[model samples]
Target: MNLLSKFATVGGATLVSRIFGFVREMLMASALGIGPVADAFNLAFRFPNLFRRFFAEGAMNSAFVPLFSKALEEKGEAAARDFATQVFSFLTVVLFALTVPAIIFMPFLVRTVIAPGLNVCIDEAALQQALSCEDRFGITVAFSRIMFPYLASMSLVAMVGGILNAYRRFFAAAAAPALLNVVLIGVLVWALWDGQDTRALGFAMSWGVLVAGVAQFVMVTVAMRMAGFSVALRRPRWTPDLKRLLVLAGPAALIGGITQINLFVGQAIASFKPGAVSILTYADRPYQLPLGMVGVAIGVVLLPELSRALKGGRLDEAQHTQNRSLEFALFLTLPAAVALFIIPEPIIRIIYERGAFTPSTTAAVAAVLGIYALGLPAFVMIRVFTPGYFAREDTRRPMMVTMASAGANTVLSVALFYVMAEQGIALATSLAGWLNALLLFHGLYSRNLWIVDRSLVKRCCLLLLCAALMGGVLLLLMPLLSHWIQPGAGIGVQVLAIGILVAAAVASYFALCFVTGAADRQMISRMLAARRKRGARNA
Candidate 1:
């Protein structure tokens, strides 16, 4: 398949997952609102999710894919399978070690790292403490313990998914995440049906997370077996291969998990205020749809593609891949960033303003989502550029850059959250994301690893203008549709309004792309022609 086709396979699946996630979040907002239960549940889930990113998506994908790709390209599938098995065994042992300790130390983690602000309300009113902080704290700890096993399951999923991705089997792993949202939505539906309280719902969802993790792990493992690559259990050995994987994975942990690290930092700081964590979490979901579809698809596809190209000494192909990936990222993301920045309120209101989620809460979440939109491209660029470094087996530099970005985010979040509240934290995360993206881009350029091609520069400029023009159109359109999108509108009307707004925005942006010659029609025709030729040959 072509590059864009491969991207679509992953991205399309991610789009499905994000749509389900939106439903899940809406249910949570309706059921729990931004109250203690919401705060506790969000914090509890974020803890394991933080580690899942650190281990599974971040370290495992970054460190494992290239090595697996190399082994497949050079040493053949048997050797690659053997290598995967070794890593699997090691990862199993490590996750067991990590989960057992984390569950045992759940309370301490909740009080200190998960939500330190719970212990001492910085606000003079002590509103946070008055809101049964001790009870919320205990709930967070218990919920965290119930869900901690998810980390192990997802980490293993990553290992298996990495193997599938290396074999260019992207669908299974990409679709696996949808199960988490599916499972959670089922739990929410059941809870809502049974009229369960927020506390009961929280516990149910925590267990749902564990169940979803196991489901995801099983799905990917089954896919691997079907792909003729079964990774059997083996004695964990400290061979050179295992040692090498460790060396590469260590620094990569930071590089891969930069977004999660920033979010963790923001969550920690946002914890000082009651409902702030939930507010930020709610705000975070809207922008994540675009990020997951564009940024994640590029990251997953680019790493293996670039690794194989580099391993086979295909420099031009590798360079072209990076350029196209960046171009593709901006093409989708720029418009999304602009639309979200322009119309977050309607989106948030339609999605979350049903039950305990009030108009005021919608406003709060919208503001944060707007600021996050500003950094959306930077966040995706980090995903696009990091592969350039990892494909070449240079993780330390990106790791250093990641650490610096995290430090900036921490310092900025701490300083800003005090002043601007949740919006300040959002701004800090965006600023830090830009810093991370720029450094990665510069590193690639300065080292002669990647050069900014003229086509990319031209298309990016055009896409930016296109996005701005689309934003202007949205600015003009929203007021006319305000009646339907306003807080008191019927849910069906609100949904229809958003659908109309998105359709118009997307229509205008792509129309502008073709009009401005930003989108290469000839290249698209060639891809189509290539696919037709392949189909004919198979026939």
Candidate 2:
């Protein structure tokens, strides 16, 4: 498949998954708003998700995709499959070992790292009246243990997903995450409809996570089998390939862990403030939609493509891929950042300020969302640039850069939390994101790995201009349409108003892109045409 086609496949599937995720978050907000239950659930969810980055999405994919793609290209399918099996066996053994200890030490983790604020609040009578903080802490620990096994299952899914993506079978791998959201939504709906209390709902959601993990793993494993690459568990062997993978994977895992630690710091700090954890999570959801669709889609496609190109000694192709990936990433992400910054209040109010979620909560979450918006482009660019290092099998430098970013995040988050509260934590994350992106870009440039050309620069500048214009339009229109997006407005009206505003923003941005000649309409048309012809041939 062509680059755009592969990106569309992954991006389109991811868009679906993110939409379901939005629904899942919306339901959770309505059912459990920013209360003790919501805080507990988010804290528990964060545990596995933090490790998911380290084990599944970030570290594992970074190390596995390039090497597996190389094996497939160089030796043959049998050799690649054998290597995959060996890795799979080793990964399963390690994850199984890790999960047991993590589950056993869940309380210690919650006390020291995940939610220290809970212990402090357990003595506050007022907080106890709302929901017993001691009980909530216990629930958080139990929920975390229940959800910890998901890390193992999802890590295996990531391995199979890497195999599929390396072979250009992107659809099933990309779509697997949607199943988790779907499962969560069902569990939440049932819990809400049954009039279950908050604690029961939280417990149900934790179990839902385990069920969904199993389902996702099954779905991707089926896809791998369909692609004629069934990687089954075998006796653990210390092969040279496996050892090299571990070497690369160790640093990548640390890099991913560092990024998650930044989040951990934010959450741990936010935990001290009532409802701040859920507020930050709610704010984080909207920006994640664009980030997942653009940044993740581009990164997933770019890594293996770059590896194959560079391995084949195709420098120009690799360069073009890098440039286009960055251009495409910014093309989608810049406007998203602008919209989030410009209309955060209306967006948060319309989507989340209902049921138990209040106007005060909306305002707080909006502030956090706006701060996070400032870093959206930086976050996307980091994803686009990091593949340059990973595809070249260089993980140590990125890990070092992440270390610096984590240090900055820690200092800033601690310093800012006392001053600006939760918004400060969000702002600190944004600043750290920019620092991380700049450092990654500098590393690539210093190594002569990334070459920025004129066309890429011009397009990026035009994209910024278009986004600025879109932001202006949004700022101007928001006041006029404020009543329809207010917390008291009817939900249907709010949805319609937000939809119209978003549609206008998207239309105007694309129109400006066309007018400025920054976007190549003919080139896009040709790509679509080529995709169609290829589809016909396959048929």
Candidate 3:
């Protein structure tokens, strides 16, 4: 399959997952709102997900895919399988050791690392007599313990996913995340049907997270087997290959650690104000749609693709891959960021306003979402650029760059928390994302590892102009459609309004792209022709 085809495979699946995620978040808002239980559940899940990203997605993808791809490219499937098995055995043992202690020490983690701001609730009079501090803290601990096992499951999933992507089987692993949303949606549906309270729903959802993790692991494992590869855990041994994998992965792990620390700092600060954590999370969902679709597609597809190209000493192919991935990331993300920045409230209102999600809550979430939108391109570009480093097995540079950005994020978040509440935290994160992206870009360019192709640079400038025009269109349209998207509007009306706005915005943007020559017709034709050929081959 071609590059765009691979992107479509992963991106199409991620789009499904993100859609289900939206439905799941909407149900969650209805059942829990931004209440104590919502806060606890968001915090609980964030804790495990932090490690999931740190150990699994960020570290494993960076280290594992390249090594595995190199083995498959140079050595053979047998060598690749051996290396994968060793990593699997060692990773399993490590995750087991990690999960047990995490669950056992859940309380301490909650009090210190997870959500330190929750300590304010212990003082009762410190913030307000809002809810039971003891109850919130206790359930948060319980929820964390219940869901911590998910890290193990997802770690295995990531390992298997790396194996699959190394073989260019992208759909299964990308689709696995949708199962989480589906499982949680089922849990919420049952809770809503059974008339469960917020506390009961929180416990149910936490368990649902663990179950979804297992499901995802199973899905990816099956995909690997079907692809004629299987990983059996051997007794743990420090094979040279395993040592090399860890050596490469270590810096990536630290990178993930720093990034998660930045996130935890934001969450901790948000925890000081009631509902701030959930508000930020809710605001995060809309922009995540585009990020997940474009950014994830690029990250997952580009790494393995680049590894193969660079391993074969195909410098031109690798450079072309980098340039196209960068162009594609910006093309899709810029308009999205613009739209989110221009009209976040309408989007947030349409999605979350139905349930216990109040207009006031919508306002708060919308503000944060707008700030996040400003950084959307940066977030996606990070994905595009990092593969340039990782595909060459250069993990340390990105780690150092990540450290600088995370440090900036920390200082800025602390500085801004006193001024703007949750929105301040969001702004810090967005700014940090840009810093990370720019530094990564400069690192690549300065080393001549990623030379700026003329097409890429020109298309980027044109895309920016197109996005700006689209933003202007949305600005003109939002006020005109305010009644249809207002708080008390019918859900159908709101949906239709959003649909119309999106259609108009997208139509105008594409039209402008074609008119201004930002979008290459011949390149699009090749993508389409490749799609046809692949379909014919399948038939």
- lDDT per model vs. reference: 0.90, 0.88, 0.88
Q: Which ten residues in a row have the lowest lDDT in candidate 1?
A: 121-130
Worst 10 residues of 2 by lDDT: 121-130
lDDT digits (tens) for residues 1-539 of candidate 1 = 88887888899999999999999999999998888878888888888898788776677889999998888888999999899989989888888898898889888888889999879744435332234656767888999899989999999999899999999999999999999999999999999999997789999999999999999999998999999889888889998988888988988877888898999889989888888999999999989999999988999999999998888889999999999899889999999999999998988998899888889999999999999999999999999999998888898999999999999999999999989999999999999999999999999999899977999999999999999999998989888998999877898999999999999999999999999988877767777787688789999
Candidate 2 C-alpha lDDT tens digits along 1-539: 67877888899999999999999999999999888888888988888888887865566778999889999999999999899989989988999899999999999999999999888754455342276767878988999999989998888889889999898998998899999999999998999899998778989999999999999999999998898878777899988999889889977876655546667789998998878899999999998899889877888889999999999999999998999888888888999998999889988987788788888889999999999999899888888888899999999899899889989998999999999999999999999999999999999988789998898999989988999998888888888888898767888999899998998998999999999977857757777998899889999
lDDT of 2: 0.88
lDDT of 1 at 246: 90
lDDT for each residue of candidate 3 in 1-539, tens digit (9 for 90 to 100): 77887888899999999999999999999777888888899999988888887766577888999988888888999999889989999999999998888888889999998888888744445322256888889988999999999999998998999898888889999999999999999999999999998888899999999999999999999899999999898898988888888888888876645445666779887888888889988988887899889988998999988998888899999999999888888888999999999889888988888668888888999999999998889888988988899888899899899989988998999899999999899999999989999999999999999988999989999999999999888888988988998878888999899998999999999999999988876777889999888789999
Which scores greater on lDDT, model 1 or model 2? 1
* TM-score-better candidate, 1 vs 3: 3
Q: Which pairs of residues clash in candidate 2, taking residues 3 or more apart in a chain or in different chains? A: none
Model 1 C-alpha RMSD to native = 2.1
Give the RMSD in angstroms, all C-alphas superposed, for model 2. Answer: 1.6
- Runs of candidate 2 with Cα error greater than 4 angstroms are 122-129, 257-259, 534-539
TM-score of 1: 0.96
Off by over 4 Å in 1: 121-131, 526-539
